[model samples]
Target: MNAAVLRQIDPGMPAHPNELDRKRIERALGSRQRYRYVSPKVSCVTGGYHIESPCCSRNIDADGGVIDVALLHHDAASATWQVFRKDHRTGAWELHGVHQRLGSVTDVLNADPERVFWQ
Candidate 1:
């Protein structure tokens, strides 16, 4: 995990939406609740990886309504990462955002709509 994106426990109100999203994502990532659902699958491509969690699609839980979320491979050389969501209507993986560190990836995960899947 890159130090720049590492999340710090503030124990106070988040300064912004991204902060809140990051915290929630960290919680979700550590949660065993996700294990109750199906494990997300991953695929390796020439340049990166693809991760998909089907249980998260259209599922409801304490966090929020689940939607289709994925992690698309970004730059292999730099080890950069990007998040994507499958458009329910168009069936395309739309870009959610990018992460430079491990903690930021949690923020990306938190940004995902609530569903039952675990990644």
Candidate 2:
């Protein structure tokens, strides 16, 4: 991972998504029935968040026991969100899609048209 891309949010600064956006993200993920049993965990980063879930696959050991579901970053200049799915083999994030709203990103994760995020 690039050092710039891994920047951590400053402790004194306000959270990247703020409370309202956080609530929206939580609600979006909550609405998915699949998440009810194995809820995804969300963590704040400098520009956005990382969504991860518990690993139960035979390859779980290789993934450190958790699977990275998605990465969402806000592009302030364009006011849009960039979505990324983990390339588990390489432990890198690959751009999946981009959307104008956070809800749209969650929708794509839920629909998983290409079987990217869920896998």
Candidate 3:
């Protein structure tokens, strides 16, 4: 994972991502050590509002810390599908600038055919 590529993949530092965008993250990680990752439904402050969409969250141990990857689709604010990953270094589930779409995710994974698998 090149730092440059990571930056390019996630240009905008969006604080909160939609539910749909969080679902498609697994497709990018491919085969990694499976860990319990629950993609909790987004709860809005507005009592009467609900965002119902297919979203997901997956976790992988990168550099001895848990990294979360979430994907969503067709969010109201961000029309285009978005993806993001949370770094476990800050001691909080803060979404870092690792945004990438399903296509880009797949492309990034495919780009490294000989990636060393730790399994």
Candidate 4:
């Protein structure tokens, strides 16, 4: 988590679009959200999944959509993370702006932050 990015955002807005697409991305990183919904187009495009990830992390989206976090074997020891917002053709929530999420560096170090998967 960098102070520079946080300073630019309101800290009351969710992360910007296509930053990383990781789930738990909003919370783990720390962002703002009012209400979010998945559109039929987006759902169809993403195969009904509100979020998509090639492999980075797991959790959920601002819309309560299930976005999971995954870790790469090569970066298994890395502690850095990033989150991106999803766009909806359904105009669920206005993509008015963007923001950054800051993970607790202390927590990652103390807990040996492991990749979180959905139950």
Candidate 5:
């Protein structure tokens, strides 16, 4: 295969979050007060984390599967965290906020002032 073809086929792996940052992110999400009752689950992804909670609304899904809550990615180059909210209808991740510290991102998720992430 040509170089271009190889590049297209394998775009290369995403930058992995360092252990310290990863642990901090996980702790922030796991200890969210709003989700304490729900017991949110946090999974490490290529460059960030995926958070989900058990579905409670039958109208949304009859199976009661977990629902996407939020996504947080670390941008090593920028030294910042990017927060995203899932659009349930379109299944697309929309950028919500960005912060330099994990605690700031946690505050946004906890407050959810606009009902974006928690909703």
Candidate 6:
């Protein structure tokens, strides 16, 4: 994915996806961490290590690009997604176990596919 597109999609670097209804876990003295991801398949993606730890940290490009979904994983202990930060600092998201793939999304079946099929 293009870096420019990534910047445009995640202008604020929000911890979770705007559409995710989940209320991520929170820890004391820290802001709550949340996870958001796009699920076209509507079920748990359980086959690839890359899915478990996406280096670019999934991002979407509603405007037009190579991505169309983004997810945020929260670290309950630190109360923030260490993965996104780690990717920013190093200019790359590592393949460590910390970049674990998130669970399945329950609201996907009910999602509004307005722009999805139009493309």
For candidate 3, the clash count comes to 12
* Candidate 2 regions with alpha-carbon error over 4 angstroms: 1-15, 33-36, 57-64
lDDT of 6 at 113: 43
What lDDT tens digits, residue by residue, belong to model 6 across residues 1-119?
A: 54346648977553333223232111110221222232232112121111122123334333333332222354534544322212332345442224333332212212314322112
CA lDDT of every candidate: 0.48, 0.73, 0.33, 0.28, 0.74, 0.28
Candidate 1, RMSD to the unseen true structure: 11.9
The runs of at least 3 residues in candidate 5 whose Cα sits more than 4 Å from the true structure, single-residue gaps closed, are 1-23, 30-35, 57-59
Q: Using lDDT as the measure, which candidate wins?
A: 5
Poorest 10 consecutive residues of model 6 by lDDT?
A: 24-33
RMSD of each candidate? Answer: 11.9, 7.5, 13.2, 15.4, 8.0, 17.6
Provide the lDDT at 90 for model 6.
Answer: 38
Score candidate 6 by lDDT: 0.28
Q: Native-vs-model 2 lDDT?
A: 0.73
Model 2 RMSD, rounded to 1 decimal: 7.5
Q: Which one wins on TM-score? A: 2
- Writing each residue's lDDT as its tens digit, candidate 5 over 29-86 gives 6655454556676778878888888766533456777889888898978979899999
Q: How much is 45 displaced in model 4, in angstroms? A: 18
Q: Which TM-score value belongs to model 6?
A: 0.19
In candidate 1, what are the lDDT values of residues 1-119, reduced to their tens digit? 33234435443422222433334443455543444455444444443444455444333233544444454455535666666666655667777667776566655454444531243
**Residue-level error in angstroms, candidate 2, position 20:** 2.6
Models ranked on lDDT: 5, 2, 1, 3, 6, 4
Question: Which residue segments of model 1 deviate by more than 4 Å?
Answer: 1-36, 56-68, 76-79, 110-119
RMSD of 6: 17.6
Q: Which of the two candidates, 3 or 4, achieves a greater lDDT against the reference?
A: 3
> In model 5, what are the clashing residue pairs, if there are any?
none
User: TM-scores for all candidates?
Assistant: 0.47, 0.74, 0.28, 0.18, 0.72, 0.19
- Model 2: per-residue Cα lDDT over 5-63, one tens digit each: 33354444433656556556766887663435667778877789888887644353545
Could you give candidate 3's per-residue lDDT for residues 56-114 as a string of tens digits?
Answer: 32123433332323322333364333323333345333322232344564354334343
